[model samples]
Target: MSSNNNSRTLLVIALVAVVVAGTVPATVAGQAERTGGTVVVEEGETVDSLEAFGGTVIVEGTVTGDVSAVAGDVRIEGDVEGNLEAVGGSVTIAGTVQGDVEAAGGSVTITEDGVVGGTTSIGAGTVVVDGTLEGDAEIGAETIQLGESASIAGDLRYGGNLQGNTDAVAGDIEQDSSVGVDLAPTIQPIASWLFAAYALVLNLVLGAALLALFPRFSDGVADRVSSAPARSGLAGLGVLVGVPILLIALAITVIGIPFSIVGAFAFVLVVWIGIVYGRFAIGAWLLSLVGVGSRWLALLVGLVIGAALGLIPIVGGLLNLLVLLLGIGALAVGLYSHWRTARRREREPRRGVGPDGPTTD
Candidate 1:
């Protein structure tokens, strides 16, 4: 049961990572693009960075910067000059990483030929180390195994059952199950509050950026939500319920997997944008009530109120959901309206004034 739970948690984490990687803009210097299919760095090839989702990621060449993936499997057979971060069904590293390795998944395996030059942190159902790690290892899993070939130059800290070859060398070995317990009742509430605060700040920052980048679209979404509350809410509810069903149906077909992944990514992106727009709308309304007309002030006030409401028990959750729905609907409607208007204008017959002073189409 514990192993099963851990596996499920890893799966959830992988999916969430996929959604995030699909939506968030990449900041890498080279090869920054989104793909629903596998990303391969073939032998003798090199890349500055790579981010992929849905399909397996195989790195058999070299990477000068970070490599991240959320997929079925991540296999590193060459060398990573920088950090490697991955969430997947399984992670297998048989290469050399000059920087850190952070992985969360069903299983993490560092082959006998693998070499990690920096810290290695992993959370999974099972972990097997049969390589050389020059830095500390922090692992949380249901089972951990260190093979005879394993050599760690730094401290080893782990939770859960452990088995290792006596020949395995490490600076120190320590068991710390208490860290796992802290994730439960003891500190969950505090963690939740901290996460909420962080989310509030992040949203505020993103919202401000969005307002600056697309002021007209932002205002249109907010106005639509205010002008058609019922319609927007209903549309949002439909999208919230319908999109997942569509994705699941698409996933049923083997050839449709990529499409489903892309759809899922788009859905998540829409929800996030909707939530930001909804919060901005709320802030705008609050400011209007106070006879203030500053978008910045409105955003600050709305975010504070929304974050506070989120702290509430059941009511807060429901309110947030409603707001999210409203925002999604409004954005969708506004975009559609704009597109239709553009199309109609393009289709209208061009008119010219003749010398007779009569307009002709």
Candidate 2:
């Protein structure tokens, strides 16, 4: 397979993935609609941006925004103010599309009544066009047919057998043989290393900032992790498991949805901090054994060693998990201690000698 074929295959796969993603329950923050099963926009009906994923999708009304569908069959016989994108077993257009049309399927067609104002791109097993295309047309298929009424305003580039009324095309007609999947080249290893390097840099910067801004708190967390590794690990495990459960419970309600989202982000940040702290604590402990007390040096040593171990396979992953647990647990324990102390102080009575002897505050 050639590069063009590879590109087409990727496009089709991506289209399928998009449809699958739409099935997940997620709120889009605007005037958009998403649904599964047979979807039909009845005549005289109007909708904003629409996405359908299921057996069949048909539009006979007016769409003021873009329309996208991934189904067994999709047919449009309406007015679309925005682009029309579809991937299915069959796709047909018999309406006025004010924007581009991107379609991939077993069979794709543009009926006589179809009128496109922008470029048209299609990838399918078979393609037929008998409409007005005001822009360029790039098609990849096993078979292509352009009806006598077909009118393309721009160039036509396609793959496979072309048997149609070429005279109706207003621009150049060309054949591209290489329009399928290409299986060559490997870049996963390089990409992995690059990602690791980036992560290391980010962690180093973050660690430096934490040590500088909150020296006492950072030292205390490290001390707790070093002094009570078992306790810290248990706490970390609880947090790792419990946070998700709590978030999910919150997400079950419409009112709690926003809070759940915010909590999720905050949880991620806490986990990252824990990971850094875990490494820093280990470095500090190791340095202490050698009678060293430089916090900066400890941080550098711990992070570098952690990064190196990360390159190993199973051992690296396990070690990283352990550190994350220890660090998070220590942080949690320390916070609980602070909260308790504050509460105790607030409850304690302050005495002042005055005319009423002693006054409690």
Candidate 3:
């Protein structure tokens, strides 16, 4: 394939990795994974296991357990006592792996210093191995190059034409016609759609619960969003930006630390509430325009519409941000109004009954 085609293929591989990685729960097997941005295992560091999602993954240390990565690129120049599984745009190994190696990328390379004690499986656009493979090797690639120093103790099964294999030592070498077919293009969209569906269901359930528990309050908030959107939005922006600053300021003092902790938790909860409320407000307005008066219907419409718009790229992100701000602001405005009403009642003078009539002082 041409270089451009290879690059496109790699991009697809990276996308597949990102989509799959995003779906993993926060914790797995007693290990918390790092998501987004670079993940690195520096030299001299030893970890039980390593699992990374998105961005680049680089390992230069010793891992007692498996090293699994779904990212843009993966480079391992250390030792893995367990298996190594990497799926990304590019994968490179220049160290010793005690267990199996399963790698899929646009470009996969195992340098001369690399050694795999277990089987090695690879799917890529271009693959080069100048290392030692103690077990069988199953590779599917557009181009495969085996260095003269490469030594495979077991059978080698490959889909593409082999180069330098004449000088490399290996067991039985067979061609597998099925290995080179690319499935990423077909699978990525399906995976993304499933993720979106999952998110929609989760949001719908949460919205339903909120509406059920606080029907009147929910309606008031929705109305606030519809009637005073500009005010609500401004409030939301202030809360979003101001809350953190307040929290930090509180945390700076010894006595205010406890309050800060409580506030932090409350802030997270309020943000979630705002997101839901914002969507509900839009839905309620839309329903009003059509002369409908059903809270459930409004929530459904708003959430569905929000999810649909989220599918768009930049526009979707911008809209979601606006929705969040509006929802948060509306909540702030409502609370402030309640506080002011209470204060006003406290300040009002009481009326006393006189012989002739009632009198206020």
Candidate 4:
């Protein structure tokens, strides 16, 4: 496919993913009021910014906070205090931003006068930065067009195999990133290695124990990750954002006692979910090993070998991602399994519940 066609395809996929994953709708196009074919956030508008608006957003106003739009044609003509994350058909930065701009679209542009204090990243066809990117500009695209006025304070990294105009990068060149490296420098390699190794070892031990004493628990966890990603994701997000807020609110009101208690329990559930995911990954690996060799040695040999390989530096990060992906998948599957089992056994139970409303088994 042509580069434009490829970019358009990815853009559509990303738009769908954002909507499904976040599920929060926002009509922020009216931020600066409408004018002509553009939806402008005109000057002198101080606000909470916007989120998930599906229309074109043309901003010429002042935003005190972050602005995020899903599937909007994002055009920034104002100043924003916080970051801007946009997934749209097209993105254009015509003003200034005090923070980063993360955009994914068919095409992106930053005009000569546009200024960004932080990074500006794009995943699309062509990124013409005829503006100033005070921080780095990372792009994954078919071509990068650098105008004569373009300047970047940091390195410019590209995903597609292509060179740029000499004037495209008016900054010092950094190390060229490669696909074989899997963008390891973006994250801590040591941390990834440790996480992968830990996941392998811990899951192996848990899987072996489950196979020996409680095969049902192993089965339960795996089913949850695979079939109940929504619940897991919601549950995970709750642990990260909701729990802390719930606790603070608990201290504020005596009437909110129940909510605080629930938050505490939810925190525990998140940890349990993590454990369940780990064991499931280990179990899958064990099965793979047994399929290839001896069943008796699968429990011990699978973990030792898998984990040992995880400590191998460059390969470890990808291994860690694979383990995590499996664990998350397993959690969904495990949840579904648990739910079906519960419903099967309780077909004729009492309607008005009493501690029987899907208690953690």
Candidate 5:
């Protein structure tokens, strides 16, 4: 079969895999899993789905289902029947996509030979389109370039410094400078307020859940933060500065790619958890000062206050960062302390009276 035919077949297989995986639980039957490596779908090859966590993902065949990559570069030179989603680094499409293309990265580029049958949405530092898009294009970037050969059958909506050839054809061109503007008056005050409210609510919910699941651990983290504020903040600052450097160093080795990916994900998870804990700590402290002691109430109050502060112009960002660092650092210290306690227990001799005599077991 030709490469195109193979690509289509692979795409179908990928879709089937997704459907099957979704309907059937993995515990029932062990499912195939791939992680932390470059994925190359060579010419005439096909895959159910292509997912890469950190390393590069190159497709030269066909993908029946979705193609997704995080903290990695994705290059498509074949065909995708389903959606293409990428985050971080860059995305280059020089093939055919039968579904929508959504990318958030440093840069996104569609070569002249590229073709998209569905909508294209890209959020990046730079976006260059020199291909054919049958559907609408929504682009948010610092810079957007449309080559002369570009042809868009649907509307083009972009926000950024846009430069394109007059010959580039599209259904309509709409430029909205507010598309990528951040922390500016691009959006209405009401919308910004609503967003802040939403974030506050979400954090409160997460904080409540964490407190319910791990009350002792949560309390311990908060206590650590209160006891050693400066130390925790310093630790957090170190992590904030050191993690990216570590990731870069790991990426230098082919064998370390998977580890780098895992570390990156772990770092993000830690930061999120730390932020939640920080808010919880703040709420608890405020409640203590007022002689009220409900964890739930504290979470609610803290989240509200934090969200409101975040709505402030410049000081809000710094305050949030400080909270994040303090939380992360406290959590780290608490873990280390726990580890030490466990080690001490393991090393200490246990005295017990046996049936015959005193013994250590």
Candidate 6:
């Protein structure tokens, strides 16, 4: 087989190794995602926040509230009145701003004309700050470069290597690992909440849509999923850790690998479906909770809740954990139920071979 064909074949075969897609869900999705698209928040664009996943986010107008994203590239050419957070390839500020800027990506740049009233925090491969910082500049990266034009009025503190083209009385500077810009940890309340919000909304919307379009199919899947959520969750989690090991094991063997490979492909397909399915399921419940009994109402409520929850703290974290557990539980239950049902069916005596004997009739 050609290399491409072999790879495609191998890819299909390898999917069987998966077990779970542990939730931290949005981040997991965005970890390898890329974003690309100009998002012009036109004048009078009254947006409370901006969120882009696995794509480019371009702000050419104004955003009045906090902007958070996990994307490919985030370019701000307008103005932000609040905080900016992202996990991306590059963050470029070429406009005016009125808040703190926090970013984790490959590189971050603030143009000479850029204006930041609050702190500028970053985690990247390289950070070139030529803007005016009214507050502190806590640059966390592999290399920090400040042009002569850059002015940071507050304390300069960072763990990464730095070369200041300008000078300041940085209150602290530490090269410790902990000081580096770090992705928010899971157990942290807000961190978990944000994650949950994303998953909940995403899953809910996806689930509702799927269910709505295919009521019977949706019901069947939901029944299965809800019935075995824990098992499914454990299975998903297991897949998270075991898939890689399984793949390695497959690679080690030759004759035993054929079917193992196909299962791997099927596994990936299942996960993608499950994620969408779970999200939609959550969306439906959210709609009902908000007193939106209409189908359309449920969708709008789900999306809105997703966005809002993403902004919340404790509740948001709970939302994430809840959806994850519930979804997994459903899947787990479905499997257990199916197994039990099958076993019961098998154990039942045949009509012709009844326990009392067919001659009784």
Which numbered prediction scores highest in TM-score against the true structure?
Answer: 3
lDDT of prediction 5: 0.75
TM-score per candidate, in order?
0.51, 0.49, 0.54, 0.39, 0.53, 0.41
lDDT (Cα, tens digit) per residue for candidate 5, span 331-350 = 88888888999999999999
For each candidate, what is the lDDT? 0.78, 0.80, 0.80, 0.59, 0.75, 0.60
For residues 38-82, write the lDDT of model 1, one tens digit per residue: 567778877788876544678888888888776667888999999
Regions of candidate 6 where Cα sits further than 4 Å from its true position: 1-38, 43-46, 168-177, 184-361
Where model 4 places Cα greater than 4 Å from the true spot, the runs are 1-39, 161-171, 174-361
Error of 2 at 74 (Å): 29
Error of 2 at 301 (Å): 1.3
- List ranges where model 2 is wrong by over 4 Å: 1-187, 353-359
**TM-score of model 6 (CA atoms):** 0.41
Clashing pairs in 3: 236-329
Model 2: lowest-lDDT 10 consecutive positions = 180-189
Write model 3 residue lDDT over 197-257, tens digit each, in one string. 6556656766776776668878989999988889899999999999999999999999999
lDDT, model 2 = 0.80
Q: How many clashes show up in model 1?
A: 0
RMSD of 2: 16.2
lDDT string for model 2 (117-219, tens) is 9998887788899999999988878888999899999999887788889987889988886542110011223323443564566567667767865688899
Cα-lDDT of candidate 1: 0.78
List runs of model 3 lying over 4 Å from the truth. 1-191, 349-361
The 10-residue segment with the lowest total lDDT in model 1: 179-188
Every candidate's CA RMSD: 12.6, 16.2, 14.0, 18.7, 12.4, 13.5
lDDT of 1 at 26: 34
Q: Assess the local accuracy of residue 112 in candidate 2 as a C-alpha lDDT between 0 and 100.
A: 99
Q: How far is 179's C-alpha from truth in model 2 (Å)? A: 21
